[model samples]
Target: MMSDVLKNCHHRWKTLNQRWSLQTRLLYINMLLVGLMALGISVAYYTLTRYDKKQQSRERLNIAFKIMQDDFQERL
Candidate 1:
């Protein structure tokens, strides 16, 4: 009877260990997904910021061109 009980206990321990390992694996996967999402968002934000800066620079250049043209016309 004691041997039977010991065997059952051992089996239960193994089963519990397997369950815990699976849980850990799932947790790692979830963390990976979150990390990927954060990276993607960061990349998108940076891209948008760069695009906005480029657009502002273009607008400033256009204004400068207009001023230079007006000045040249006045001198002529």
Candidate 2:
């Protein structure tokens, strides 16, 4: 079943290749590559920003906890 689907896809791709001009095909391929690269960069940036924010949040919590502890120690 999978093989049949793959063969159908291959047939369609060959038909499309034959129908499109060389310049058109190259333009499409270049656009696809650029789009993929842009998507990768965007995802990486988002991941790093999220990680940095999480680290900052954790640091803030630790600072607050230390302040509370210091106050308790002084009172005791």
Candidate 3:
């Protein structure tokens, strides 16, 4: 089943190659690759930014808890 699909895809690619010049095909393929790469990079950057924000929030909470503990100790 997979082989049939692959063969069909190959046949279509060959048909396209015959219709379009090689340079045009390569240019389109390159553009697709660059667009995918840009999308990946943007996703990675957003993930990292979210992670950094979470880490900062956790650190701030830890500091607040530590300050409260110090106050309790001083009162005791």
Candidate 4:
């Protein structure tokens, strides 16, 4: 099964090589690499932003709790 898939891939690659110039193949390869890198960077950025937002929310909640506690003590 694996060999069949490999054969198929080799055939496709051969066909592409025959149809496209070397420069065109290189251009496509570079574009694919750049696109993958961009996707990775964007995902990392999104994850970091989400973590930062959660941290900020947790800090805000703690501050609010502290204020309520102080106010209650004053009333007593």
Report the lDDT of model 4 for residue 61: 100
C-alpha local distance difference test of each model = 0.96, 0.99, 0.98, 0.98
**Off by more than 4 A, model 2:** 1-11
Question: Each model's RMSD to truth, in Å?
Answer: 10.7, 2.7, 2.8, 2.4
Candidate 1 structure quality by residue, lDDT tens digits, 1-76: 9999999999999897777877797898999999999999999999999999999999999999999999999999
Query: What is candidate 4's lDDT per residue for 1-76, written digit by digit as tens?
Result: 9999999999999997899998998999999999999999999999999999999999999999999999999999
Residue-level lDDT of model 3, residues 27-69, one tens digit each, is 9999999999999999999999999999999999999999999
* Order of models, best lDDT first: 2, 4, 3, 1
List where candidate 3 sits over 4 angstroms from the true fold.
1-11
Model 3 lDDT, full chain set: 0.98
Residue 2, candidate 4: Cα error in Å is: 11
Cα-based TM-score, every candidate: 0.69, 0.80, 0.73, 0.80
lDDT of 2 by residue, 37-60 (tens): 999999999999999999999999
TM-score of candidate 4 to 2 decimals: 0.80
Candidate no. 2 TM-score: 0.80
Clashes of each: 0, 0, 0, 0
**Which residue segments of model 1 deviate by more than 4 Å?**
1-20
